[model samples]
Target chain A: MNTIDHHWQRFTLRQKLSRYAVYLVLVLAFFQSIQSVEVIPEFLLDAPEQMGDMFSRMWPIDFAYYPVAVHDAMIETLNIATLGTLITLIFAIPLALMNASNIVNSAWCHWISRFFLVSSRSVNSLVWALLFVSIFGPGVIAGVLAIAFRSIGFVGKLLGEAIEEVNMGSIEALKATGASWMSILLKGYWPQVLPAFFSIVLFRWDINVRESAVLGLVGAGGIGVVLDDSMNLFQWDRVAMSLLAIFIIVILAEIVVVNIRKRLI
Target chain B: MAGIKSVQNRENPFKHNWFISAIWLLVVCYVLYTFNAMDLSWGRINEGFGHASNLLGRMIPPNFSRWSLLLSGLIESLEIAVISSICGIFISLFLGLFAARNMMPSWVSTPVRALIALCRTFHPVIIAILFVKSVGFGALAGILTLIVASIGFIAKLFAEAIEEISLKQVEAIRATGAGFASIILFSVMPQVFARFIGFSTYQLDSNLRNSTMVGIVGAGGLGGTLFSAFQRFDYDFVAAILIVIIALIMFGEFLSNIVRRIFR
Candidate 1:
């Protein structure tokens, strides 16, 4: 009697070898990173206790402190976020059009716009705020400019994608009529991209609100100024209050974005 | 008169909705009001430009004499990214399943969703600040902050991925008399694992960028050095550090692309 042989394997030999190699490399990297980390053993040991103590102090948050310093700063943060988003559209629109291959029709123009967008995104808002604060001598304007510069990449990238995805038939129809470039853009791309453009703008505005809340930490200006002052003064209660305000505002901004996007899109 | 009005309407193909127009009007007014309130006059902006150019002149020819110091900070940021991404991805696997509406009961998923939301609500820098206050400052705080950030983001994405998977696979597995856990292992996981890898790689990239700066809050990395250089008016050194950070992020982007290709 001859017995039938059966064989089953989830992966081939070469696949298994590659996966094992990847795993080996990952393990080596993990241990290497662990060795380089400089953790204070004592601090690590008492982390839970330290966390408890900090939480205890944070309790009984000073709600009374909100109106005194946080109120005006919160308003200024909203203004910075709003103004920054509005200003971003000014620079973002042209750059987005330039970056859209179908719209710009020049590889050189597209690359220039791409470089600017990438550099803008690579630099964090806080870093931009640091640079702006030095130039503006520390104020809301620094915060606003920081937000605008950081947002240009995000808004431009999304808007460019929307432009690229527009119905080509409409554009071709406009071109066939011997329409001017400006009119073709207005008649063809504008309607197709408007909804997406508004949605992207609103989404960015929401993010800008959260970012602006912390810009003051770098002395650019916002509720973060109050947060920094409170932290410095060891006023944990006031810090707690500031955190609460930021939390509420972020949630509210999300709701606003969702509602506006619903109607616009 | 009606014929003339109809022709005018035809001339303007786009109808002007008063509701949208009203909203636009309100936005314009609000912008003008806020502009006035910020007190950003032309003179101030002009003066700022003058200062900016002067500062720009100082940052030219970035100083890299302290290459060792810069290298150490860059390495620390990398380590923090790696460690946090690993731990965060590990934890999110469980949290994500618990939070998936289709996989778990509402009672379980609801609280998990809320917890994820809380983690996501604050910026990692803010979390790093709190961690610094508790952990007494170091890479540990930065790692913890990024872990929370990772879990917040990836868990939510994981849950959404799971929800979108075909339930027919689950039913097919269950029909074999397989238990709930086995069903999840055999069916649910295979479907979402690819997307989870994508999210993990993206999170790693994000964590790397964030780790470079969490040091600003004394969490530990290049950001502390950058902040100190800025305050010290060491413009050239700051420029050098910014260059290194951009290079690091670009390298991370390259690494992630390779990883995604391998998995795909």
Candidate 2:
């Protein structure tokens, strides 16, 4: 053992050389491809001319129609996010509790909950939206359901971990006092987990707002409908305007969410 | 008297015993009501399942007649995923570092953090739509969209990882007369590098999945192919594309594991 330890203390210079060789080859390959690929066409610079022609046809961003529809569309988007987050928040609590091995008190229940959570989280929100649109005929309801389903998995998993990390000592103490299981949870677990739960809710809300925009592509309803319309019609100006609007809304919401998160976390 | 008063206040603290119970009851009732309202009937569910099964049956023999097209789309999607991740991660490294409140000034961190939050505020699909509209239908739009999405997630997480790091090592390095850059390079980065790798790999996996879907918005990828298949009701092709997507994602997961191992 002593002789092996003595030999192990030595550093090999060859190892360094081999690692550098690998690094150099990888970097070289990256630059080589960059040099070889003619990504931009000869006519690429004419892109601005095309853009200018499109812009000239629909100049000024149509501010006259902004008040007529933007507010309603914006509200609809918010409503989708709200309803989705609300549904997820409601479904997630029990699932989170059930998924937490420390809370479930049964092996089968824990495994089942784990399976459910994993499967739910495996599919992305867009995929869920696509599936729901196929089944529910594409509207706000489908969008809400999609977001809600995705949120359930995310919130449940994170909240379950939070629940598990709560002080076991507190729960043991409550149980020692002859409290019921429900009472022990309400008193011992809820308060400790509430702050994290609130943060997750706000964070998810920020995400759902962005997701709700495109839900309309499959007819789930929102600015995505407008976006699709403009694109299909090749109304680049309208598309640009809508894009600008979405950016502003997202940035504003982001500001609010960041402020809230800072205060909480 | 003061002690007694405090105890009484603590014990009697406006017991909203019924309030909490009522909230829980309301939640349960709302769920049941919504479930029924959604018309998620057993018969309908069964019918849907049957239709899905029929679709799946047709999809078994995936016809790869457009092999070249599919391969080209797949390559573009991979390019989008890789290029976006590289660019996004490079930018995020600086943004994240700047946004770390403990390391940087409040004025610097605050705005950077806000920008990250904004980037993350929207889904990548919506972002793709916006980019496609601005940049026109192409891989450029897809790359830009994924980059925005990456910045949103990676920067926020990186900032968080940095904030959570022990400043003790950083302080020790500084005390040893190392420059600010050197101290960060040696002390701060080593602590967060593994976590940064973890976040990057996770983002890459997500980006790969997203790259396929960006085509739906005309940003460029297999998603456009998938969308057309869906529209044409080509269930077999859809199945084939789905299988391919799943394989790609699984491959990405394996790659991520390798990355994590290397970083570790």
Using TM-score as the measure, the top candidate is 1
Candidate 2, A22-129: lDDT as tens digits: 447545644553444224543345656754676675576755545666656766777777678888977888889998988888988888877667656655676677
DockQ for every model comes to 0.64, 0.25
Scored by lDDT, model 2 comes in at 0.77
Q: What ranges in model 1 sit over 4 Å off?
A: A1-20, B1-12, B17-21
TM-score of chain A of each: 0.92, 0.79
For model 1, residues B157-182, the per-residue Cα lDDT tens digits are: 99999999999999999999999889
Docking class of 2: acceptable
Tens digit of per-residue lDDT, candidate 2, span B100-210: 999999999999988887787667887776555456787777888999999999999999999999989999999999998999998999899879878988998888889
Against the true structure, what is each candidate's TM-score? 0.94, 0.75
Point to the candidate with the largest lDDT: 1
Q: Candidate 2 — which residues are off by over 4 angstroms?
A: A1-59, A105-115, A174-188, A255-265, B1-14, B17-75, B95-122, B133-136, B156-184, B243-247
Query: Which docking class does model 1 fall in?
Result: medium
